[model samples]
Target chain A: MHIIIVGCGRVGAQLAQILSSEGHNVVIVDKNQESFKRLGADFNGITITGVGFDPDILKRAGIERADALAAVTNGDNSNIMVSQIAKRIYNVPRVLTRIYDPLRADIYKKFGLNTIGTTTLVAHIFRSALLKESAKHEFTIGNDIGLVEYRVEEEETAAKESGGGKK
Target chain B: MYVLIVGGGKVGYSLARRLADEGFDASLVEKEERMAKRIAEDLEQVLVIAGDGCDPGRLEDAGIARAQVVAAVTGDDEDNLIICQLARDTFGVPRVIARVNNPSNEITFKKLGIDTVSSTTIISKLIEEEATIGDIFTLLALKRGKLSIVELIIGPKAPAADKMIKELRLPADSILATIVRESHIIFAKGETVLKPGDSIIALATTDSEMALREALLGKE
Candidate 1:
């Protein structure tokens, strides 16, 4: 699948490398050319140096034919604008954005755009790890339901599988 | 009316001060705490909120919920767009205006149904109008840059100076709308005779602006 990733930051570079290695066509855009270095010499992908929200830059990145777009720019507003342009203008099938502000992320989600608030998610993860909690909240679905992962010991799993779980 | 102005840059600062002076309730939100404090001290009538305008919480604190109009004049186009969207879509503000830092982003802003003012576009237009020869000035742009209403002065040595309107070879998609001679306005007609010093207001396709000017004032 043809994918366009805005911002060649750590996450964007990693995503690009993984997708390109998986044989998917990946094009990453960053305002600074220096950001492309994060992708490393072995990474195989196209790099565009321009603002992600710019239509001309997006067109040059082949947004019209992109199967998916990820806007992981450091600026939340820039990411939101790029995701909106990819989804509403180019009609890219899949679009995702990373917004650091949780409130803004929730508000943008109401606009029908997929957003991940790294600040909130990271905080949640840190809290769970620091507390050594068995259950970790991965993400919240809509306003209420939270999808959580519960860690179980190997013995507990084996016992449960044998229908001998502790009461 | 209560108006919320985002970004404490020069444009936003001056606009908020002017609006407050005009007896309107104006509130400004600036990301830079120092600048916001300076503006708060400078503008007695304007209320200043120090926070990121893109943040809905900051906007709400600046009275976005009751704002009749929201103007996002940030230097960053993306931030302005986000603030406008938050004001219009979330707060349901009746009017939202954004300042597009990059002139090319004007169309995108317009496409998203957001009113945009591009200083770059306006400044470039002024420079273009000033640099234009033959005393032709673009009065207004219409049809999304497709057409322009221009005011051209018929110079003493112009080709169409003393010619009849019907005999003048105007550029395609161009028509003389009216002529102001000696403070008298005359609606252009086929039989009307052109005269030197007459300021002709014509409607022409933007692409034909130069041709129209050359047709009236001759090649310069």
Candidate 2:
């Protein structure tokens, strides 16, 4: 899939690197030139420096042919605006935006936007891990389906996921 | 009527003050604390909230759901567009008015169902009006300037004064419509005598304007 990821923050950078490694065409756009440093030296993808929502800049970033777009900019308004432009103006099929504010994220969803709220997602993960006994899955699709343990007090969730060999 | 205005710039501030003066329940949301405080101090009757107007929480706090009309008059076009969209589509505000800073964005705002007031277009029109202001005010210039209705404020030195319409040699295709005096409007006829300080309304074609101006004011 050809993807245009706006913002070169941690999530954007990691997503670009992984998607590019998987042989998908990835283009990362950021207003700051220093953000490209997060992608490392060997990663091959286009980098654009301009406001993400600018129609001309987006066109230059291959928005016309892009299959997906992810707006992960720190500003919620910027992310929402860019996502709306991609979806409504350019008719991009797949559009996603990361909104940090939970309430604003819900509003975006109500407005028919696809929003990923890392704050709420991480907060849920922490609450579920701390409760331990409250996360009762009502149904399981397959025997391999397992909810990996996340340590709320420790940084062991990443290690725990790899250590579990359910697959 | 309840009105919620986004952005506390000069436009929003004056609008809020005027609406409050008219006894409307008006509220203004300003992103800057200092501006919000200053506007709050100046507008005794309007509700002022200090926060980003684009934020849904702040808008809700400012009573967006109950607002009969929402005006997004921020200097920024993008911010204005989003605020109006959110107010209309999300909250179902009955009326939404957006101030479009860029004339090019007016069409986009209209297509999105938000009514826009483009100051750029209005300012351009004002500049056009200033350049054309004279004794002969071309009210309606039509069809590539072929036909027009021009009004002239006749002064005491005007040579057309005390002259009957039929006696004066008005150019062909030009006709007098009305003589607007200080107190009344006189529908001009062939025998009507033009007087000093008479505001003359004439309908003429493009080529006849010079002749009409010369006949009324005596010269260029």
Candidate 3:
């Protein structure tokens, strides 16, 4: 599959590495040439240095034939614009964007755009960890279906066994 | 009409001031609190709100629901695009205008039915018009910049000076619309004779702009 990923940050680089190693044609774009270093030497994917939302740059990255496009730029607005251009303009099959603002992510979802907001997701994960709950809120499928991950550590099992008598 | 402007940069600030002075209800949203306060103090009529315009909540605070027009003139094209989308799609504003910092993004904005103003395109056109072809000025660009209506003043030594319109070798796509001699407007005809200092208005495609300029103003 031909994949185009905008932004070469940690997540972007990791995704590019995994996809590239899985034998997919990957092209990564970033505004700074230095960001490409995050992909390291083992990565075998094309790197483009230009604004992610610029049509010329995206075309240069072969967006016309891309099966999937991921917009992971730090700027939520940039990611949203790139995702829209890829999905609405180029009609890429799969267009995903990362938006830091939870409000913006929800708004774009209402517009029928695929967006992932890490701010809320990470906060949920941290909150669940801090509360030491076995059921960790991973994500929700929709309004009602919440997918929770259950963790059963040895220490948790021991604590439960010891507190069983007290209860 | 109520106008909501996002971004506190020079364009947004001055636009709000002008709109307020013109008796239109205008409010500006600036992300920087200090700049917003400064602009609020400077402009008594316009309302200034300090918050990121890309955030819908901030736009709501600026009263986007009842805004007749929304203008996003931020330096960042992405932010402007988002703001315009929010204004148009979410709030259903009658008109949404955005500043395209990168000229390449103008098509994207236009495709989404958002009006765009590119300072880069405008400034470059002005510089090129002033530096090389001082007499020929672009009155308006139409058809997505494919066609332009231009005005050119006939110089004393211009090739077309003292010659009839039919005699000049105008570009194939060029059409002379009118000739203004002094303050009187005359509809251009094949038999209309050109005179020095006459301002000629013509419609031509972007590709024919240089040829039309040369035909009227002579090569510089």
Per-candidate RMSD, Å: 4.9, 8.5, 6.2
Give the worst 10-residue stretch by lDDT in candidate 1 chain B.
Answer: B125-134
Residue pairs with clashing backbones, model 3: none
Candidates in descending TM-score order: 1, 3, 2
Q: Write the per-residue lDDT of candidate 2 for residues B1-220, one digit (tens) a residue.
A: 8999999998999999999999999999999999999999999999999998988789999999999999999887778877887898888999999998767666556656678898778788668645644578778988745898998877888889988989888899899999999879899999999899899999999678778888888775
Interface RMSD list for the candidates: 0.7, 2.5, 0.7
TM-score of each: 0.88, 0.67, 0.83
Candidate 2 stretches with Cα past 4 Å from truth are: A133-167, B75-78, B101-111, B121-220
lDDT per residue for candidate 1 within B1-220, as digits (tens), equals 9999999999999999899889999999999999999999999899999999998888988889999999999899999999999999999999999999898898788888899998889888788778875388878889877898999999899999899999988887999999999999999999999999999999999888999988999887
Colliding residue pairs in candidate 2 = none
* lDDT per residue as tens, model 3, B77-136: 999999999998988999999998889898998877789999899899778768876677
What is the alpha-carbon lDDT of model 2 when measured against the actual structure?
0.82
Range of the 10 consecutive residues with the lowest summed lDDT in candidate 2 chain B: B125-134
